[model samples]
Structures are given as structure tokens and as C-alpha cells.
Target: MLRRLALATLATTAAGLGPLPPLPLLAPAGPDTLTVTIAESGHPDADGTFELSCGDKAGGNHPARDKACERLERLAGAAEDPFRPVPEGQPCTQVYGGPAVAQVTGTWRGRSVDARFSRADGCEIARWENLEPVLPLVRG
Candidate 1:
């Protein structure tokens, strides 16, 4: 019986019949999508729009989709809120970093996201800068 089974297996291999099915015939699932927009307060020419998809595959119109997704992953790991409020009573520099404002609206890991960013104050500036990996300055 053992010899017969071995012969059958050899015969199947020789006939190009394998246990696994072909992978190409199966269609892959789609990725999740995120929309990001940056608008300069007084400089419309510097505004930009980007789209990013993360899941089974990385895609979308974002120039750095992979890097953006990675940054979002790190943010999730730390349970950090991208829209955290500025610390009360914390004195900030009275300087203007820029007039750039950004908004990120999408779903991440099944959670809805609507984060807004600006470089108006010190804390907000930090928040905006922290997300630089995903949202870079795009001068139109």
C-alpha cells in the first residue's frame, strides 16, 4: 500500500497536478482610503490635496502613501490624538510659523478620523510638525 501511494504521488507530480490552487485567479481585496487637504491661509497656490489607501495594499494619489500609512500606524500605537487640545496656560512663542492649515478625514482600522491641523501656536505647531511624515508642505 505504501509503495502504491508513493507511485500515485509521483504520478500526480509528473502530471503537473498540485494540491494548491492557482493564486492569480483569485482577486485581492481593496485597501482603505484617506483624504488629506492642506490650505494656506493667504496662499491658495500652495494648497494641495492627497488621497491614501492602506490595508491589503498601499495605494492612492498621495505621493508618499506608504510613509503616511506608517506614521498613522505609529500614532495608533501610542494612542495619541492628532486633534489633542493645546495645554492650557502653557505660554507659547508669539511667532508665526506659517498660515498653513490641514485637514485629514478618513477611516483608520475601522475608526473614523477627522483631524485638523494648523501652525498658529506652539502646541498646534508641534502637532502639525509631528505629522510631517504624512503631510509635507506642498508649494503649489
Candidate 2:
């Protein structure tokens, strides 16, 4: 009965007609999700993970998801690199602002971001500062 009906359906499908369509995939729990982490080099207490989401509705563990998303959107649109590399042979002041490191992973505006940021030198410090509010500048 049931078994025969099942076999008949399977046979019909395999006979010549196209196979059944695949099931629809479920939407993600949230769009534009990001996992952000910041740590002060050598300081374990300052490290923590923040989950964020941005889109028509912005929300997540991040304290300022809306602002963070706004900054990220701006960064994505900027002609200059938000995390521009320091040009070779260009001398920068020997300034060690503080060894703060940040990691941003996940999707933003439907694009992946697996960027690490650090303030090891003047150029790096400038890059980190540009990402501020999104990745807060750590002071020693």
C-alpha cells in the first residue's frame, strides 16, 4: 500500500520526467553578520567577542551596531583603503601608541571581511584609529 505508492512515485520521477526540485534553503539567522574581537597585546582581560548584524534592521551583541555598520559601509565605499598599507621607504614617527589588536570576521553588506588590525607603528596606529568606534582605540 504505502510502500507500493512510494515506489510508484519514485518510479514516475525517475522514468523520464525531471527529478524533484531541491528543498528551499532557509534564510540565515541574520544578514550582514560579523564577529569582532579586540585585544590589547599582552592583556587578556581586554579581549572579548562581539557579534553584530547590519541591514534593514541592525542588531547584535555589539554596543554600537548601527554606527559600526555605518562606518563599515563608508569604508567599503571609500576610494582610499580603510586599512591602507604603509608605503615602503616612507619614514613614520617612531610612535608606539599601544599594541592594540583587532580582528573582524564575517559578512558585511554581503561581502566577507577577515581583517586583522594592529597598532604596532605610526602607520598602523593611523589605520586602527580610522576604524575607531567600530574597533575602539586602546590606550595604554
Candidate 3:
């Protein structure tokens, strides 16, 4: 009787071990997101400069031309220098005054993505549409 009880207890313990609850599969990393960095130039009256690193289809937009231009002008004024003129031989005309709006098209991971920017301090301030994907995490 004792041997049987010991055997039964062992069996119960073994049964309790059952296969480790399906190891909750680890989630895979999703697509990358947009990243922006702003730095203040030491020079007085220098508008802060920003660098934007775009990722995947996560960034794109179609902001109104006038609005974009306005933003660009503000950025330039803050940066203490107007937009740099396009190189002498460049196909695109030099942008000056107000905002600089141009369709921003790019390729990432073999996919085509588009975005718009208002040139500020020689950098692009991403519009709402382009910034939407990254807003949630950044907000809090």
C-alpha cells in the first residue's frame, strides 16, 4: 500500500509538470520608425538645426505648398541663414523666401515612400502625415 501511494504521488507530480504552458511566442520586431534630432547652434540668434532619419513607409505626407513654405521660412530665420541655394548646375531651381515645398519621395526596404517638409535651418520639419506613425511613442 505504501509503495502504491509513493508511486501515485510520483505520478501526480509528473502529471503536474505537463508541457510548459506554450512558451508565449516571442513577438517579432516590427518595421522601423522615423527619428529626429535637434541641436542648438552655439552662435547667437542661430535657429536650432535638426536631423531627421526616416524609416520605411512609416513616413510620408502631402502638406499644402503654402503652409510648407511658411514653415521653411521660419526654420531658415531661426537657423540664422536662408536655405542654401541649389548648386549652380543642379536641375532644381534655388528655393528662397517663405517655405520650401517639394514632394519628398524616398525608397526603403525596396518600397517607395513619399513625404513633405518645410525647410528650416537647412533641415526638413516633417509634416503631420509624415510624423503620425511616430507620434504615439514620442508623446508619452
Each model's TM-score, in the order given?
Answer: 0.63, 0.63, 0.18
Per-model clash counts, in order, read: 0, 0, 2
C-alpha-based local distance difference test score of model 2:
0.73
Off by over 4 Å in 2: 1-30, 41-46, 79-91
lDDT tens per residue, model 3, 1-140: 76876676677769995333333453233432222221232322222222223323222232222343344335434752222333355453243223333333333222344543343422233232233222111110
Question: Which sections of candidate 1 miss by over 4 Å?
Answer: 1-32, 41-46, 87-91, 137-140
Error of 3 at 114 (Å): 22
Error of 2 at 135 (Å): 0.1
Q: lDDT of all the models against the reference?
A: 0.72, 0.73, 0.33
Which candidate number has the best lDDT?
A: 2
Model 1, span 1-140: residue lDDT tens: 76876777778888889533323442234455688898774555436888889875678988778887788768867977665557789888765667788888887656567888888877777877777656775322
List model 2 lDDT by residue over 1-140, tens digit each: 76876676688788977455555664355477888898865556447788888777778888777888788778767744454456788787778878678888887655467887887778778877787667764764
Q: How many collisions between residues are there in candidate 2?
A: 0
